[model samples]
Target: MARYIFVTGGVVSSLGKGLSSASLGYLLKSRGYKVKIRKLDPYLNIDPGTMNPFEHGEVFVTDDGAETDLDLGHYERFIDINLTSLDNVTTGKIYSQILEKERSGKYLGNTVQVIPHVTNQIKDFIKAKTSGYDFIICEIGGTVGDIESLPFLEAIRQFSNDIGKDKSLFVHLTLVPYLKSSEEIKTKPTQHSVKELRSLGIQPDIIVCRSEITLPKGQRKKISLFCNVNIENVIQTVDVKTIYEAPISFYKEKFDYQVLKHFNIKNKKQPNLKPWYRTKNIILNSKKEVNIFVVGKYVDLKDAYKSIDEALIHGGLANSIKVNLNKIDSEKLKKNQIKNKLKNADGILIPGGFGKRGTEGKIQCIKFARENKIPFFGICFGMQLSLIEFARNVLKLRNANSTELNKNCIPVIGLIEEWYKDGMLKKGDLKKLGGTMRLGSYECNLNEKSMVKKIYKSKKIYERHRHRYEVNIAYKNKFESKGLIFSGLSNNNKLTEIIELNSHPWFVGVQFHPEFKSRPLSPHPLFASFIKAAKNKK
Candidate 1:
């Protein structure tokens, strides 16, 4: 008997519905209610796994291995909850399941239609998964008027009736544009957006308005009158300095009070949001700043490097400093013309990516970092490139290459691999393209005297990984002899988890995605240490 809060956006997309939903969930949780957030994407793609980062932003992977929308990343960071594949759904996945059932003759030769069949599947999904929680805050992707979202809207509308109106509430987020020439905020867009929702048989209980400035009392009353919501329930959301400040800001605006009143839940103890407020103050009042260059192929889209960016920010927070990130295109460095771009950066970081394009540039950047004794951190493919650079320069392997690029490469960095997971062989040929190599979290045993162990202050640690190729272990001793310390290894002693340079001030590479687990309150240790080292370089 969980109460449902359906969140939808109008006027336009990117209205911060995801953040708003997460903030609401946080507020509700603080009031002593069990809360869970779910996302319903209207896209036809089964998941974001195969989509390009430029097209769709970052594909967030869950503990249960669901490649989900980047908003799930925000959800996890805000709530400290580990989401699973079941937490997100798209039109493509819903229809694919229905079609499979049809193909198997499970429908008994009935003609399939969007209404009873598709909508039924959607409703079933909602009802089945959301049964036990106190509040299930579901955010619908896309705007209200989009054609792809019509069925989802219909399903939610019907679900409200089925569950009774008292148990369900709709929160519509809309943009209130301010015309600079007129110097006045317009409410016409929100008025029309509400009209659209009303046409679809859904009435919003709360209206979260996004604007550059606070709405005047007159404008708020006008919107309340037109949209059929109380003036008190019409909340204004202005731009904040940091995303972490959202909960505190919204709470001050009485967002949780409105939600509880709408759902008829008694308020418990007052929320203690001092931690979020303190984090924002620390970021805003920092006296020191350090610039770090993140070299990657997906520089055009910030979401592709979402976790990495946040982790670096967290690092800055740990040191009470500001981290100014310079997004450097790895492809541009292929011509050896990026010296000017690298000049002012206190540290250089090469993040993970796929394919062979721009890899040589990444290797070149690694060489530059190593030669200059700059603080450097490499991840996944970045780690592989570091080894390749070391092999070419120090090992004197003239044509050092990865097996991913040159399949027949001598002393290949990539090899056809098999992993023993719980004594079972998940067989897949190395030649195949999709879903190979090590994925998800695995344990790594850190060398006791290594820099990584000292930084983490632990002998055993686990981190999430997403990569296809690994460094050839046969070259381990040779590379170690050349001063590359094998700082971390898998429990079985076969896979390398971390590597560092003993002679350099701060240089490390990890095969896992540490950024995925970083938070504003709890920065990842590696990033915190890296930023500290970068500050020292300054």
Candidate 2:
């Protein structure tokens, strides 16, 4: 049986509950215990697939085609685990399942209520498929006291009671605001947050305080006394220069020690943190720097491309180089400004996004990178745009664009009508906007002589994807005649997966998202190779 640790936030959102859960999972894993981390989102949306980037950040795609919260990316990167659709649950998903069950008469015409039906479903979701792990760390999304999170709170409250107190724990994260004017740290919000949690019948076993400065022993003791937690269990997590330092920082504060003590497990061996220390040192002491421009529609909000941003950093970590990312807003870019704006960029990256918001500008950026011999890497939508750029400039197709943006064009990129997922032939639906894409992981076979093959050193690889359109295979020969190599194809040899310019220095576009698999300790091969090429460009 796996022990449970429910992580909840208080006072405000974005307090790094996901990071805290991931850090703890990493610590336990280092201690040679099997662990898994899950995110229980309170949003009513079935998934984040249809949500706007500004509204919900990136929609992370798991291997099993679940478009989940971006925090799953944090969890995967920190713990180095590949999660599944079962790992993420949302209110919308829960309610929809229950309504389906009721419609199917699974409840036998009983009144479908929140207490047993909803709470039981939530509990079943948590405990399902969790037999082999030693610990299951679940991070509850949204802050406490929100009406949407009420049932989830109640479910967890009941969950603790049913599972016995010895096997369940709650960790509450709250902000410890530092008022510079008064030069005093306030603990009332944390106290009130705990009070709110206790009102819901969930007394937190530990309180993780997020503060700008270290909490003095006096404040720690005060928080312990007011929140009714042990003084030693009141852990402080000060802001660090890099998020990679989180596990190490938490370990320094004995956060993991307190957690183990609560479980009454007697393991005195310390976690092996040399990899984290080395990564931190490299981040702080790298001498060589490469400026990579991330041209995208969501440049205004860095979180919109959270995984890509972190993957580039992971690339730099693998090469002992400092990556300076220049986020360029594609909407504001003009054709004439491309050269001057990217003159100093050693490499250029275009991340995946939907709609035709700033696509013309992205095409211009790709053209500049290709013509100037700069290291260029493209992903998903980026790959489609690269195909369009090649079709227009090289093949003399005057009007080339994706069918998603324009109905009448060269159709360099168009909707993939059908694809195989889990051995089922899934068809694309024009009416649905949610969960209707060629998603999850798929296999691609690499051409033996391709640059990507050299980088990966493998003939076959599986990468995660979240897209509706693909490069039109009807134009493959035309593209190849113009020196654009379709270097990779799907297992059936029907879909184009990767493309490269035979004459260019380092230009590669992939239809699948390699950024999803990049980690700090072991960077994805494509990212590591891209960073190496970018460094050589300097």
Candidate 3:
């Protein structure tokens, strides 16, 4: 038996609902309770895998290969939990499953509508994934009145009543915009958002007011009276210096205490939040600093590389330094600008992306880093382009390209048509580009003398991958002949998992995303090492 906390946002999207939910989960876990955070996206996309990074942000992949919303990344980083595919759901996925079941007569030849069919499915999903967890915090995506989210909203409403009021709690997060000119924080948006939620027959057990300034005297009371929530239950979530401080800030406001009080669950033990406090101290007191320029396609949106950005921050924390991250949009960079922008940087990074846009610029940047001996790190597409750059400049393969870009040329990179698993080279189907790819955790065997192996201090390690194309294995020997070390390979020795420059200061490209595994307490080894090298260069 577990308690359910349904967290929904209003006024507008991108209000840190995910962060708040994860922080609450962290607070709960600190109190000796098992906690799991889930994201219920209202998007019609089956998963964010096929979506553009500029639009939907990073498609966080679980260890089980489920492409989920970026909010799951926040949940994972904060709660330190390895979430599963079952932890995330979307309108597209739910509808796809329902249609499949309908076609198979799982609905018993009845007309399947959104009311009972969709709502029941949603309830079933929530209950199914809650097994063995003491607390499940589900953050519903989108605003309260979005047409796409109505089914999910109604589903949770019915669930709260059906499961009894004591078993579930609803937390509504809405904005209370501050008018600097008027010197007041308005609560009309919060009032209306709650009224809309009430129209759906779901009254929030707790109302979290998001504000830029402090909640003025009598504002909580006014919000409580108008929103129909108790004054003590109206919690103010103010902006913090760092997101890692959110759990502690909310704790100061007694957010979790109110939640537990609502549930009437006696405190079993006090929460140990020293880990968060310690990390915050490091961030606040770091004396040293280094600049790490990240050149990427989706540089316009920081969310596109949220994990990468955070990983770099964690790397700085590990080294007791401040990481100054500069985002340069590769699409707009000229040849001279690449050198101009990167000349002062201690480190350079190119993250994962799709398509051919800005690739030449990315290649130019990689070449500059390679020749300058700047500590460089490349991920997925970044790794692939490095090979192309190496082949063209080092191996004299001027026409080298990936099949994903040019299907007919000399393919240094090509689609992963098949993989050897369970003692078999299974044939692949490339008909769909949905959630299908070499995703999640896969073992990579490291060469004993490689720099990557030294950093990881392990001969065999597993990292999560998210790519449709891979470095062609046929060109391994030719690439290795040119001092392009295939430092790490898959368990079958057929897929290239890691690449490195043997003579450079610190140059490494990985097919898998190490950023996905980085944490605040213990940063990813690759990033921590990369930042250390950057510190050395500075």
Candidate 4:
């Protein structure tokens, strides 16, 4: 039987509930307890796949192809756990499943309602997935009073009662705003937030207060008294310099201790946080710094490039330097404005994206990087653009383009198709949009004496991929003859990856999402090498 901790946010959004949950999971895992974390989103979207990166940020893809909320990425990085599609659930997904069953006559005309139908579905999701783990940390998306999140809250309240109070606990994350006019910290919002939560039959056992300044003893006691939680359970979560410091910082504040004490988790040994501590030292006290420009469409919202941004930071930790990222809109390059934005950059990176919106700009950036000998890295769609740029300018192929944009692209760098697990072809000679692509981790054999091989220090590597079109094999020979190297390939001799200008300073690209696997304590070798190359350019 696993003990459950349901985390909720109140007073406001952006309260670091996801980080808090992840940090607690790390502490529990360090104590030799098996743990799993789950995220319940209250949004109506069945998945984040169709959501705009600019509107909702990056849609994190799980190993099993679940387009999930970005918080799941936090869970994976902090706890070193591989999350699956089963780990994340949205209200839209739950209701859709139930409605699908109802339409199929599986409901037997029960006149589906929220109480036993929707709420029961949520409870079932929790109970079915939590069988093996000793502790299940579940974070509910949105604040307590959100109308969209009511069903989820009601389900959790009933779940706690059904599982017995001893087996479940609730942690409320609320804001402690500082009033500049009064020169004082306010606690009224938290009181009201708690009161709202209590109205729904859910009382938080612990309160994680988000504040810019440390909450004084008097303030902490007052919050505890009004919020109806213990004084020790009122954990203060102040902002830190680097998010990697979260595990160590929370440990010092006894965030894990309070959690264990609430659930009576006795005799649990402390976690050995040597790796995190070392990473923090490398990031904060490093002697060097490098600037890298991230050329992409979703530059306004930082979360759109959340994983890529953090991966660069991790690379800085690996090389004992600070990474200063300059977000440049790729669309600006179509008008020849990218050069001004990238003039001071030590390196240039083009991350993955969809459609042909700003692709011309991306191709122009790739051309500039190749010509100027700038340290360059292209990921997924970015990799395809690099090949297209090389084909059109260097090889002088007049009709080079990605099949994604034009199905009849002459020197097709991207083709609409699906390759199977056993080297078989699927949707042969047919084009379908929904779920027709190579997704998840796949092995690629790296050629010896190649840039990728040298960076990885391994002949074979597996990386996560999420794209449909690949470099057309028919054009492989022509591209290779023109100095473009197909240095990494699948076992079937399919060109799954590429690198360029071996004699040049630094240039590489891959058709995989390496950012998905990078961790603060363990930076990806490619990013580390790219940053190192950038530093050398300085």
Q: In candidate 2, residue 486 scores what lDDT?
A: 96
lDDT of each: 0.87, 0.91, 0.89, 0.85
State the lDDT of candidate 2 residue by residue for 1-538, as single tens digits: 7999999999999999999999999999888889988999998999999999988899999999999999999999999899999999999999999999999999998999999999999999999999999999989999999999999999999999999999999999999999999999999999999999999999999999999999999999999999999999999999999999999999998888898899999887789899999999888888889999999999888789999999999999989998999999999999889989999999999999999899999999999999999999999999999999888898889898887898777777766553223332345533342234888999999999999899999999999999987776778888888889999998767678999999988899999899999989989998888889999998
Looking at candidate 3, the ten consecutive residues that score lowest on lDDT are 418-427
Off by over 4 Å in 2: 418-436
lDDT of candidate 1 vs native?
0.87
lDDT of 4 by residue, 1-538 (tens): 7999999999988889999999999988988888999999999999887899988888787777667888898999989898988888999999999999999999898899999999999998877766789999999999999999999999999999998999999999999998888889999999999999999999999888888888999999999898888899898888888787888888888988877777787845888899888888877887788989999999989899999998898888888888988888887565457677678889999999999888988888888888899999999998888888888897788688876787555645544353321323443533442246667777799888788888899999988777877777666777778777889998777555666666569888888888888888678898888889998999
Candidate 3 segments whose C-alpha is farther than 4 A from its true place = 416-436
Between prediction 1 and prediction 4, the one with superior TM-score is 4
Candidate 3 — which pairs collide? Answer: none
In model 1, the runs with Cα more than 4 Å from the true position are 334-336, 415-437
Q: By summed lDDT, which 10 consecutive residues of candidate 2 come out lowest?
A: 418-427
Cα-based lDDT at residue 382, candidate 1: 86
Assess the local accuracy of residue 84 in candidate 2 as a C-alpha lDDT between 0 and 100: 96
Query: Model 4: which ten-residue window has the lowest total lDDT?
Result: 418-427
Return the top candidate by lDDT.
2
Clashes of each: 0, 0, 0, 0
